[model samples]
Target: MEELFKEYEDKIPAILLEELKSSIDKKTTKTQLKKMLEALYEEYLESMVEPGESVGIISAESIGEPSTQMTLNTFHFAGVAEMNVTMGLPRIIEILDARKNIKTPMMEVYLKEPYNKGKDIRKVAELIKETKMSDIIQEVSINILEATITVKLDRQKMKDLEVRDSSVKRAVEKQLKSGQVKIEGDEVLIKVKSKDDSLNDLYKLKEKMKSIYLKGVKGITQVLPVKRKDEFVIITAGSNLKDTFKLEFVDTERTTSNDIMEVYENLGIEAARAAIINEVYRVIESQGLNVDIRHIMLIADTMTASGSVKGITRYGVVSDKSSVLARASFETPIKHLINASLVGETDPLNSVIENVMLNQPIPVGTGLPGLITKVKK
Candidate 1:
């Protein structure tokens, strides 16, 4: 078996050979294994793309056609979680357009050690959420004539956050710079120093105090600790990958955000490219579509070919085209043509769209080959 494996090691890909070696039965004869190896090699050869194939156009069509079947609805997870994730066509569009601000930014955060085993998972989740002043406070009373604001903090909530009254007083003082913050038991009183008896100033101060930044990662609007298989994971609505990674208990290796630009900012272009493929394919698979992974990979490759993610839009990938006619053909033809003509740009007719515009064969498939001859002098 070792001799036979060594013989086919050079003929077939290492990955495929390893998979075959692991899955193949030890009881099988050498002849059977050799036959199986030959069959896999033959199958692999048949799956390869031919030279000069217009793979870009094919991949575009392959992805574009199945995308039409995807519904434009967002997936609202059932039960107590109540999280809304943008799926189907809208998500696909968001990804391909490379929109920085997506409709629903989310993250699946994995934890380390005992935290992943549902131990203090709720506490872990609470710590991951963005805690505002309103979250820990029970009520706010505005004194009209006195020009003062009274805030009642929830004792249990404050205890859960492990915040001291003195700390709360300082935070309140820092937040509202114009007022004097006084702590009375569980309540915080804000006295307006301007001596204005108007109701407007007090109400504005009350509203401003409600949103004072508290502990926890900012922009994490909600967190749900869901038990997946044997481990508990956090699914957050608003994504803050940079801040999320800073937590001591977070397993950064498996944790990921759905935002492409965020991933690109934290990781490099290669990670961004992989993210594009995963995100697009995730949406496709969720919609029950059967597009090939190679198609998605090709699109991802093109999007990140320039060391940065560029959308398949007129202002992005289309704008970077070398051929003047190719750029003009995408969208806003008059604008592109006018801009090219003003710059005295020339079309080499080396690509598809220009040759098609001139009623000539496209430089693909059979038309890709050309003959070079030397004349006898």
Candidate 2:
């Protein structure tokens, strides 16, 4: 391997020198010429793959003294056909190094280009074979286990406690009557019963019990509750906000816009958005769909901008013309309107552009778009 590498390395510099001479226009100063050639060579070197520190491959041993040589005669057309000249080992080394990085290790390289173009691919394969590196690289897949806990109280305890105290029993009965407790097999499932599902109480409970329960399970990764019509969701084990959102639903008639905003206010906008995005990405990825996280970032930003939890395709906060896309496309109506009103036409577009470029939305509507549109004559 060292001998092979050395052969290629020796051939690279001469190729580079020749290519540089032919490519540059009328450069007479030796110092200037050498500098330019050196820079190009350095660039070519930099483009080669750097073995990651964790890869455990000693660089000095792997990249032995390069020695390789090849000559080519080609024609160039700049008006009339002219003699095209080329030369050196350095350029070849550069190409070989680049090809090594470009080709997936231990994989057959299939090249598609003009004229016997698969030559590079074949060359890369030959290099891999010659270097005896076919078995050195391995592919790894990682699996992460994310677990959450859902707590269920003993129904007997709940009922007994209610029966023991008349006033507390009355309150508990009221909650049960209101469908707060779902009884399943002697277990009292206690979920949040308020329209405003604030997790402060749950947080308090978790804080109080966390140390005691820490030994039983892993620390609470995320605390999320499900929300239902006119009822708050129970905070269970998972921290996935998006899943929590799906578990939460509001009856359009029973829940008011104020109620939704209040819920968002209780959970910080960033946290809420992160949860929603995590859930969205989870669903998307599970289906073997590929989407950049930045798209989710945009969705999160839009959701948080209005302080209302809405889906990506929803036409409320995200669909507004004064949001991120509008600013990016130079069509922010709200900013333009504000600037036009305050600074008039004399204001520079640059200033308005700069001002609206901040990743925030201008307040309009309920911040949350209404589902039902009211018609007017």
Candidate 3:
């Protein structure tokens, strides 16, 4: 312990040194400790990049090569035909593109103690799933002669969804701006009171009435309670992270959404950075391929370093480059050249791509070392 501090006092932090001492005492023998320390030193040395080493090329090659083996089609979930996750190369593109809206937005909501232990899980699922007036409507009929619209609600479906008939009537009346909302048995009838209101008005009312917000959390279309290991978790079809986090029984720390922008908006950039790494890692791992996590981490860091998520496309990271040649190399060379000419932009030839394009030695590795000659005496 004394020798470790003496040798690595300047190199390793005090907090990390203390942790190492505690870990060594609890988890390792003297022979294992020596090997572990050596391994740590070697890992530290291997983690660094040479001054001029091109990280962008390495990262692109590392991920792009393995992605070719990924499947082209979407993978279906068992027992649920509607839920299909975008996998393989397409998913990889989505993450790199940093699209505002993904092909499928989903959420995994974890519960608190009692709820997580399988108590009233189905009830919770019902509470989280969004239910609209149209979801329970048996039929909607528009009357051109009477200039009225009548909606028939399914009694059994309403009972199953725990939606009251009175609540449905209130929502329709509010939308239609009518006080005389006649509820006859399971049917709701509304007629145009003014002579100016035509058949088109009644048809518009029918369309608007069906989309009325009835009950449950908004934006969540479907909910499925799945069992993993020892606990039951709710998988939602739509992601409403802001509203979902407000639930009293939800475990906010463990609850996560697949929408990258949603995570960025609510949780900030650090969480957004983590989400990118996790998502890319998940896609690759799902395809039964093992990749070094550091490569994915590098990409995530670059995307979020500007304090917002940026795609690899011309509109994003490429546009943000300092060198004019680097941006031109990515896409639309003539456009970039014309824009640079208009702005009178100068290329410093500092980076790898720009220097390589001009057939000059890059300012990295051996190229970085310069020798000075003394004046002749």
- When summed lDDT is taken over every stretch of 10 residues in candidate 1, the lowest stretch is 194-203
lDDT of 2 by residue, 13-45 (tens): 667655655766654565666566556667878
Model 1 Cα displacement at 54 (Å)? 0.8
Candidate 3 residues 13-129, lDDT tens each? 577667777776655666676666677667666766767676677888889888888888877778643477788888889989999889888999999888988888989989899
**Residue 134, model 2: Cα distance from true site in angstroms:** 69
**Candidate 1: where is the Cα deviation over 4 Å?**
1-11, 19-43, 143-147, 192-204
Q: Quote each prediction's TM-score.
A: 0.88, 0.23, 0.87
For lDDT, the strongest prediction is: 1
Ranking by TM-score: 1, 3, 2
Model 1 agreement with the true structure over 175-282: per-residue lDDT tens digits: 879768898888888888877546776777778899988778899999999988999999998989999999999999999999998999898899999999999999
RMSD of 2: 29.3
| Pairs clashing within candidate 1 | none
Off by more than 4 A, model 3: 2-43, 175-180, 369-377
Question: In model 2, what lDDT does residue 143 have?
Answer: 16
Model 2 poorest 10 in a row by lDDT: 102-111
After aligning candidate 3 to the native by TM-score, how far in Å is the CA of 220 from where it should be? 1.7
TM-score of 2: 0.23
Whole-model Cα lDDT per candidate? 0.89, 0.35, 0.85
